[model samples]
Target: MKKKTIIEIFIFLLLLVFGLHSDAQEDHSKMNMGQASNKDEPRVTVDVPQDQQSKIGLKTTKAKKEKTLHTIRTVGTVTADQTKEAHVHTKINGWIEEIYADYVGKAVKKGQPLFDLYSPDLVSTQEEYISAKEQKSAGSDIAKVALERLKLWGVSQKETDRLVKTRKAKRSLSFDSPVDGFIVNKTAIRGMYINPEMELYHIADLSRIWIVVTLYESDIATISVGDDAELRLPYDLNKTFKGKISYIYPEIETETRTAKARIEIENKDQKLKPGMFVNVEVKKDLGEAVVIPDDSVIDTGTRRIVFVKTSQSRFEPREIKVGPRVGNSFIVLSGLKDQEEVVSSAHFLIDAESKLQAALRKGESQPAGHQGHGK
Candidate 1:
């Protein structure tokens, strides 16, 4: 019985040893797994691989050092300059017995005879003048006054001189234009009877021209007298005429929501006339401003941005507020720094790349079925 008891104790001790050994094996296996996990840890880095980098082309521009605001654009019309505008009308209306100017739009000089008329009243005045001249040496002051009256009624100096020498009446009344202008209206025909005071013709002088310009109410504050303006005819856009603001209408036109500005331009050759439609551009000066090359900007609906290259193949887009232009460049009101490297020429490519990236990200956010792949 003593020997069996010892043997049972021995068996119990062996079983306990086996259990402890199994536990130790499990501990060693767990330690080895932890070590393997540590060995598999990835390295930390901030750079993207060359294949994953943005492949868009790029160009750069240095910001211009000037401070400018914005540009104003308006369209206007051309009008005859008031100074050169003329209205020619005849005071004495008579038959156009002999027409010197017979057509509309004919050019005439100042004091040029337009027509000749045979009038009984004119003939009677001339007869009185001839009798006055014959009696001038007979010591009558009334006769001398009648001769002066005939000279005042458009009888030419040469005609009066010939009448004084020949003592005979010259029997025709002459109508003369008082200004150098184009014949705008002609109401009289040859052999037509006329009244004492009637407008037989109309004339317009085309020495200088005007442009009727309209400026929006928002832009009216920027315009003032003597500001430079430009004109372009529709048929000849390449031809530009330069002028200055002469008048600014105090009242605003309600229907158009604009104010009228008058621009005076010289038209010595009569190329511009009344009722000419033209495109007018008011040239505003942006004295000095800080500007950027126009191409450097990328406009998102919500923000205007510019891409700044921080490192090779790396760019960051920044929001910016913009101002007016100083020629080919835009004034930077904010969100830009001088001397920074900006993608000027190929901004469109970079923008397109950004859009693709955004689209990809959006696709990843959607459900699998919504990604356009079959479920």
Candidate 2:
């Protein structure tokens, strides 16, 4: 009889433990449902007091659909245009006898003597031509061939004509500049041996120069060849150089994900020097888009919020995606519609007021026992 009594007490304790656990689980489920319901409910709207509106200078403006010119600003470096550059090289193995345009930055006109080269092969070829000229009965074909050989070695027509008329092979052959430009480079020494593989001088015309601008991938699509651009020097803000896009590099820089654009500007005064930094502005007309004042949008770094005027007094915070900024306005990409009015001024005060109101309302609506449930 004592054993049966003990068993009955043991079964009663087990039932009591399970019943307490069931009650705790039921309460927990109700708390979760309440928290989820609160999350889905829309935030309460805040009404800006009419008396305080004028004190804070609250202002509103309607979003309008209009064409906006978006300007892309970047920095670029000045460079010499490759089309106006010339590389002087020797065609034969020889020694440099003399250099007329010997200094860098020296100006040279077209057909101006640049250097003189002494080559044994050139002297031997000249002798062959002169010998063929003296013996005309030996067939003019030999002389014609030798003259062509001289021309191939960069012997000018004037030099060859003089050689044939004088009947003498000059010790050295003189070379002249092919174009009018400044000598940008000079590497040939008076007695240094030169070969076809060596470059003697580099000449470039500075009347026209190129500006290479680096642009991010996102900005590349807005620019194209023939587009007009404006350049300004940082220290000298009074003057502006205008130019057009001559080319866009097809390859992108792997590390920076940026591309290069070439702009040709006339440098009549020779003020723009190579390697100098200049600011560039590329303006493009984007078709009509929904736009609002720049002050209307509040950027929280993570998300962009704008206080939209729902009614005369009611203001609601809305999230929006914004495109490029033009002048003092921003192009709205989404979450805002045309003809809608937004709080352009004093919106930050309204944002603060709205958050406070929401916090207060949430505390009152939540159940008493669920203090830390939602959090």
Candidate 3:
């Protein structure tokens, strides 16, 4: 009977111990479940007292709907307008007789003589035209053909009329400037033999000039032909010249990975010179949009977070989408509204305090038994 009582007591003790252990394990599991659930909860607002805010130098700015003007500033080089440039060439081979334009950089007007040329072929054609003119009934067709041939050889109609009136072929003919411009390049010499294939002079009209600015791939989308631009000399900022984007190179340069934008501005005073570097500013207005200060937003790798002041003391963290930056502000694409105040200064301190408070809350929600175990 004693042995049976002892064995029964031992079995009862074993059962009691196992039941307590199971209950403890169940409680621990419930604590773990509670912790996971708290972790899944949304972030809570941070409350910063006015005194604390003052201590932290906290500041806020209101998100507002306003026009965002983007200014693109870049350096540009002045170039002669290619379309306004003229190449002086001759059709028939000749020997340069009397140099008239004489030097490079000399400004010449239309019909101004550049040089005198003596070409055997030209003299022979002029004689034929003069003979045909003198033949009277030799027929007008022959003279007309000869005149057309002279025109084809680059002889102006005025020169041809002079020949007809003079009734003689001149030893040398004067080549006149076809356009008003400064001779940028001159290959003509006093006795240099010239051919039809040779370029005699390169004339550039400086009445208008082109300012070429480089546009990166990111900026190309915002720029277009006819966009207004302002240019200023590096040495003289007080003088400003206005222009419009006249052309954009279709292909980007392989080495620079940039496209060239051409701005045409009048240079009637010849103040701008080719190859001179100038400052270029292009302004684009991005219509009304919800905007906030640039410093208010924090990029946390995966998300862009901004703290919005929901109340005087309460700031709620919000994830927002943003577009291009305009000046010192950002264009808010979503997750924000106009007139809402957002925290601008001391963001790091606020963000850290918010996270600390969350961790403390998580700890407080833990079961007592688990807390004890952790302790």
Worst 10 residues of 1 by lDDT: 39-48
Q: Estimate the Cα RMSD of every predicted model relative to the unseen true structure.
A: 21.4, 13.4, 14.0
Candidate 3 residue-wise lDDT at 296: 96
Q: Considering only N, C-alpha and C atoms within 3 Å, which residue pairs clash in candidate 3?
A: none
**Better structure of 1 and 2 per lDDT:** 2
Residues 324-356 of candidate 1 have per-residue lDDT tens digits of 554567777787777777778656544444433
**What is the C-alpha local distance difference test score of each model?**
0.63, 0.79, 0.79
State which candidate, 1 or 3, has the greater TM-score.
3
lDDT of model 3, residue 224: 80
Segments in model 3 whose C-alpha atoms lie over 4 Å from true places: 1-50, 254-257, 300-303, 351-375
lDDT of 2 by residue, 1-375 (tens): 578546545543433333311122222222211222332322234565556567667888999999889888999999888888899987889998988998999999878888888999999998988898888878478888988988888876778889878989999988888787888888988999999889898999889999999999988877789989999999998899999999999999999999999999999899998889999998888889999999999886656778777766667677789988888999999989999999998775565554444444557668887867766
Sort by TM-score, top down from the best: 3, 2, 1
lDDT-best of 1 and 3: 3
Which candidate number would show the highest TM-score if scored against the true structure? 3
> What shift in Å separates residue 43 of candidate 2 from its native position after superposition?
6.0
lDDT of 3 by residue, 1-375 (tens): 578546545543443333311122223232221232332322345666665676567899999999888778888999999988889899988899999999998999988888888999878888888788777876567888888888888876677889878878888888888888899899889998998889999999999999999977778887788889999999999999999999998998898888899999999999998999999999988789999989999776656778888777777777799987788988899999999999999775565444444445668779989989945
Q: Return the TM-score for each candidate structure.
A: 0.56, 0.76, 0.78
